[model samples]
Target chain A: MSNAAFVIIAIFTLAAALAAATLRKLMHAALSFAVALVGLAALFFLLGAEFVGLALVFIYIGAVAVLIVFTILLTRRDVGKDRGFNWAGVLIALAVFCGLTWSILKTQSLSIVAPHIRALTVKRIGEALMTGYVWPLQCVGLLLTAALIGALILVMEEKR
Target chain B: MTPTLQAFVLVSGALFSIGLLAALSRRHAIFILIGIELMLAAANLNFIAFWHFAPQPHQPTGVMFAIFSIAISAAEAAIGLAMVIAVYRHYHTTNVDQLDQLKG
Candidate 1:
């Protein structure tokens, strides 16, 4: 049932994330990251966070991933051949993974009874945004506006 | 039955590690940005998972936090890419290891 689906999506997410990190080609890594993000969004949906899941797809897949691909295309040039693999980086990442996995397994505080999931509809989210969380919601709007202007300024060509 | 919270937390930890590897090892600035995005998603996954499984399910605390985080991260991505573009234009290169003029 749902557990099977979760396992499948979780496996896909980890595999895609691994590829995204390990792939040499920038474009391939970006695509793999997109796959990983999509898998995460699916997991969100399966976890009953429907609005956040859809927003993940909309924002990450639709926006951030595409932006990464565009940047890769723009920055493309014939650099020297890839230096194969960086063993030091691999060792560092492996160490971090092993330590984190061990600590996560050893920690007992995370155990909790799984509460029954209630459907989180978009209307409820919108209402929450407009009510209790209104202040942060407005702050987010301001942040986005500032980011847009700043990006334009940064990328704009200077006059001779 | 639903997947346990422990399962979700483990997956997030694994994803965070993968992103850390990419950010640390990759020379390309774009790859670093992609890694950062992966890391942000992992953190967001934790927030959503805890929110979903918390004993008090009546509140939308996790959902609101995740939404704000996602929105802000989108802004971060935009600003990061803009900086990447500026760097590429200035140095004629996007490799982090080569841009060492800042080293004292």
Candidate 2:
């Protein structure tokens, strides 16, 4: 059942990503991106990373995507017509895809040691972060605070 | 390749590539921001996959990193969107091609 759910979520994620990339209307593309993010969160849950999955939904779907949509609405009301597909752009994208596939395939043999699945719970993570990775975690918190202040400054400057 | 892991990686790669295509093809500033978000999501997917498959002492590293990445992404979106708004105010349009003043 879990495997089936994974497959469904993966399919939804891919479809939404394609729609986000190819959609003519910007607003539609943004909405599709939200759907893709939700699918990704679901995939995380299937992988047994429930906290990360919830964070994905809360941060990306709840905040980031909505912020983008709000900004779009504020900045522009109409999405212009499709300007026709650019063949050169498509070719470049295809080239990038092939190159990345080749690189990934080449690295398939290399492996890293991963932790046991049972140790990946949210409680374990919190303990590890606070005990072993405390300094780094604190740094990140400071960084985020700075970023928030910077964002506020930027927004206020825009109004002036 | 194990079927589940293979599927996960493939989907992640496809999403990342689609995002790259959108970033490259779109001249709109906001669209580029969306593309960047897509790429970050792809990276998060990889982290979760590795967390599930690989053998270590800290299984939650991937999850922790995903959380950090998401937070960083939020900050990026805020700063990037604000910049777009500022640029739009000055130039009156969000088209990248039109902002060639610094090209010289």
Candidate 3:
């Protein structure tokens, strides 16, 4: 049952990703990207990373995707018409896909025994963050604060 | 019923390639930023998959790494979109193909 679900979700993810890449309308592409991100969250859940999966939904879908939509709204006037199919881009994507698939299939690391599956709890993650990974966590918080300030400064109109 | 590591890796690679194409070929600046987000998600997926399938999964290294990646990407998107807005304010267009004033 879970395997079937995984396959279905993975297919949905790839399809949404393709749409996000190829869609002509910027708004449609952003929506498609949201779908892809949601599918990725589902995939993360299937991989036993429940916290990461939920965070993906909350952060990417809830916050970042909404931010993209807001930005689009703020700058919607100059969206140009679709310029038709990009054959060169498709070719490049296909070549890169081929190379990556070949490399992954040939790698020997795939032969390792499967690790035991264990779902990580939020408490454990919080504990780890506050203890073992505090420095990086602090840095990320600082980066976010700085980014927020910089964005505000960039968007604010200058006083006359 | 679990998917193999190879399957996960292949899917990520495919997603990454799609993202690369979007980043490279899209004329809109926002589209390029969306492509970058896809690429970052793919890399995070790889980290999570490898961590899940590793023999010694006691440590939450991959989870930690993915979390940090998410944080960093969020910051990147904020600053990048701010730049996009600034550019549009000045040049009045978001099409990257036409915003080539920096080209030497």
Candidate 4:
């Protein structure tokens, strides 16, 4: 049953991602991207990383996707007609897909080898964040702060 | 075929490739940005998969990396979008092919 659920989520995610990439309308692509992110979050939940999954939902669905949509809204550009896919590009993409697929299949076994699902609860993650991985956590915090300031400057520059 | 980690990885690879193709082929800078995001997501999926399958009792490294990647991606998107906007304002078009000022 869990496997079935995983399959469903994976299918949804792949489909949504393709749609997001291929869709002609910018608004439609953004919507598809949201759907893909939701599917990814569901997959994360099934993988037993509940905190990571929920964080994906919160950060992606709530923040990132919204920001993209806001940018689209601000631009007010026409969502032009579908520019037909270039054959050369399609062929290149196909080659890449085939190469990657072959490499992954050859190097690793696909079987579910490890079943030891550790608790990825929010509290556990919080503890880990502060204790063992404190330095990296602090680095991430500083990075985000810098990014926030940078974004502010960029947006402010646009207004002037 | 039964769904395996390989299957998931293959799908991710496909998505990433598609994103790369889109980024390379598209003239629109915003679409290229979107394609880059797709590739980033593909990398994130790989991390989560490794964390799930690794034989360690405690391997939160993948998750940690994903978190940092997400933050960096957000920052990248912001900066890239800002550049796109500025370029659009100057050239009045988002098409990359149209910008030929460096040809001199």
Q: Show the colliding residue pairs in model 3.
A: none
Could you give me the TM-score of model 3 versus the true structure?
0.95
lDDT of 4 by residue, A87-115 (tens): 68767877888999889889756756556
Candidate 1 per-residue C-alpha lDDT over A82-157 given as tens digits, one digit per residue, 9 for 90 to 100: 4445668878988988998898888887765477666777888889999988899889999999999999999999
DockQ of each: 0.71, 0.51, 0.67, 0.51
Docking class of 4: medium
Off by over 4 Å in 2: A81-87, A103-116, A157-160
Best by lDDT: 3
Best-matching candidate per DockQ: 1
- Compared with the true structure, all predictions reach lDDT values of 0.87, 0.78, 0.89, 0.75
Q: How well docked is model 2, in DockQ terms?
A: 0.51
Per-chain TM-score (chain B), model 1: 0.97
Scanning candidate 2 chain B in windows of ten residues, the lowest lDDT window is B1-10
Q: List the candidates' TM-scores in order.
A: 0.95, 0.88, 0.95, 0.89
Q: Please give the lDDT score at residue B72 for candidate 2.
A: 85
Worst 10 residues of 3 chain B by lDDT: B1-10
- In what order do the candidates fall by DockQ, top score first? 1, 3, 2, 4
What are the clashing pairs of model 1? none
Off by over 4 Å in 3: A82-86, A111-113
Clashes of each: 0, 5, 0, 0
